[model samples]
Target: MMKMWRVGLDEAGRGPCLGPLVVGLCAVPINDVALLVEAGVKDSKDLSIKKRRELVDWYKQQMDSREWKYVVNICSPQRIDAALSKDGLNILEVDLFAECLNSLSQQLSENVSILADACDVNPQRFTDRIIARIRNWPWQQSEMDSIHKADSIDPVVGMSSIFAKVTRDEMIEEISQQVGFSVGSGYPSDPNTQKILGRLVTSPLPHSELRWSWATIKNKWMEKYETPPPIRNESINVQKTLF
Candidate 1:
C-alpha cells in the first residue's frame, strides 16, 4: 500500500486586535494518527498554557527525527492590515492557509490529505476557497477536508492548533518584554490590551505593532478626537452686519 500523509492546518490570533496572526501546519504518517492521540494531543484551547507548551516542546523533539513535519507562517500586523485592506479577512486567511498547505505538501512524496478548521460560516465554502487558492500548487492531487471545528475532533488539526497557539503566545510575550508591560493576550476583551491601545492610539502615529485599521483602534481614536459640531459664528453677528 502507498504511504499516506495527513496534513492539518490551523491558526491563532485571528480575533485579536493586537499581535501577529499565525497559521500552523503539521503532517504525519496516516498510520501514526492513533499514536498522536495516545500522546495526549487535543485542541489547544482545551489545554492549559503549561500543557500546550509541553506539547510544543515534545513535537519539536519528534520533528528532529523526521517523525513529523510542520510549518508556521506569521502574518504581522502590517501584512495583515495590507491584506485586509485589499481583501477581507476570509480571503487573507485562505491565502495563508493555502501557503502553509503548499509548504507542507512539498515534504511528502505520497498521497496526502489536508484538513483545516473552517473559519467561514459555511464549511463547504471555506473548503472550496482554500482549494481554489491551492489549485495551482503542487499538491493539487491531494485530498482536502474542512469542518466547522476540526480542531476539537481531528487530532492532527488539534496538534497544529497547539503549535499555532504556543507560537503566538511566545511572540506576544516577547512583545510585552520589549514594551516593558503586559499586553494581556492581545485581545480586545483584555483590559491590559485595551490599556496599551488607549496609550498608543493617542500618538500622532501609533506604533507599527498596532493594527491601526482595526475597529478597536479606529473607535478609540474617534472617541478621543471626534470633532464637535462647529460653533455657530454668533460672535461675527453675520445677520446684523453685511460689511
Candidate 2:
C-alpha cells in the first residue's frame, strides 16, 4: 500500500516584542495521527512548558524510526526587522509560512496534505496568499487548509505548535544567558522584558538583538527624547513695512 503524509504548520513568538519568530512544520504518516493523539498531544498553549518539552523530545525520538519529519524556520529579530522594513508584517508572515511549506514539500515523495493555523483575519484569503507563493511548485496541487485556531482543532497542527513553542523557549533561554538575566518570555507585556528594554534604551541607539522597528521600542524613544516640532514664523508684511 502507498503511504500518505499529513503536514501541519504553526508559529510561535509572533506577538512577542522580543525573540525570534519560529515557524514549525511536522509531517507524519496519515495512519499515525491517532497514535500521536493517544500519546497526549494537544495544542501547545494548553500544555505546560515541561509537557511541551517532553512532547518535543518524544517527537525527535520518533523521527528516525517512524519516518516522521520536521522543519523549523527561525526568523531572528534582525531578519524580521529587515523584512518588515520592505514588506508589512502580514506579507512577511505569508512569505515565511509559504517558505516553510515549500521546504517541507521537498522532503516527502508521497501525497501530502497541509493544515496551518491562520494568522490573518480571513482564513481562506490567507490560504490563497500562501498558495500563490508556491503556485509553481509540483506540490501546488496538494491539499491545503488554513483555519483559525487550527492548532487546537487539529492534532497535527497542535504538534507543530508544540515544536515551535519549545524551540523558541530554548532560544530565548540561550539569549538570556548571553545577556546575564532572564528576559521574561520576550513579550512586551512581560514586566521583566519591559525592564530589560528600559535598560537597553538608556545605553544607545540600535541596541544589538533588539527590534528597534517595533512600536514598543520606538514609542519609548519618542516619549523620552522626541523633540517638539519647530514653530513657523509668519511672513513679515514687507510692503507695509516699506510704507
Candidate 3:
C-alpha cells in the first residue's frame, strides 16, 4: 500500500555567524518531482546565485499552477541561542525537525513520503524523532524517511534548499552592513570571521551576536593577530557558494 504523495524537506544557513537557520519542508506531487529535476534543480550549494534565483521563479510559477505545499521556517540566531541555552544544539535541531513535521502532518496526503537531508551527526536519531512526532497521525510508514543528502538526491528538497539558502544569505548580508564588517561566511573557519572575533575578544565589545561557545571562535580569539585583516585565504570561496 503505497501513498500517492511525496514530500521533500531540506534546510539552509546552518553555519552562519549571523542570521537564521532555515528548515524547509516541501511536498512535490510525485508526477511533478521529475519535472523539477529536469528544470535544473540540484543541491542549493551546487548552483550559482543567478541560476538558483531563476530556478526559483520558474518553480514558483509551476507551483502556483499545480498548487504545491511547502513550509519554510527561519530559526533566527537568537532562537538558536535560546534553544542552545535550554537544550544543546543536537536536541534543539531535533526539536526543530519535529516542529516542521508537525506542520506537514496536518496537510499530509495518503500516499506521502518525506525526504529530509541529514543535519545532525546521527541521521537515524533525527528520523526517529520526526517519526515519533507524527506517530499519532495514523499515516502509513511511507509517510516519512530522512535521507543523508535529500536535497541533492531529491529534486523537490533541492528546490527548497535553494530557496532557504538564498533567503538566509540575503538576511546575513544585511546584518553584515549594520555591523560594519566583512563578516566572513558566518562560519567560524574563515580568517575574516576570526578577525572580527579576535578584535571582539581583545576589545570585548559586548558580543551577543558571536557564538562564543564554538571552538573556532573561542580558539582563534585566543591567538595574537599580526595584521589588520588577518591574512585572508584566497582559496576560501564563502562568497561564491553562499551569497
Stronger candidate by TM-score (2 vs 3): 2
Candidate 3 per-residue C-alpha lDDT over 1-243 given as tens digits, one digit per residue, 9 for 90 to 100: 442667777778666654577776667778777888788989999999899889877867876677677666667555666665566776656666666666766666456777778777788877887667664654665656677888878888898788787777776677677788767667766667656765554433225455544555445555544323222112211111110
Off by over 4 Å in 1: 135-141, 227-243
Candidate 3 error regions (>4 Å): 1-3, 140-142, 198-205, 220-243
Q: List the residue pairs that clash in candidate 3.
A: 3-111, 4-111, 5-111, 17-186
- Candidate 1 achieves a global lDDT of 0.78
Q: C-alpha displacement of 179 in model 1, angstroms?
A: 1.2
What are the per-residue Cα lDDT tens digits for candidate 1 across 174-239? 988887888889888898898887666654555666676687877877777783211111111001
Summarize candidate 2's per-residue lDDT along 74-176 as a digit string, tens digits.
7777767776667766776787788777676566634778899999999898889988897455463368889999999988899989988998899899988
Candidate 1 residue-pair clash tally: 0
Overlapping backbone residue pairs in candidate 3 total: 4
Q: Which pairs of residues clash in candidate 1, taking residues 3 or more apart in a chain or in different chains?
A: none
Q: Estimated TM-score per prediction? A: 0.87, 0.87, 0.77
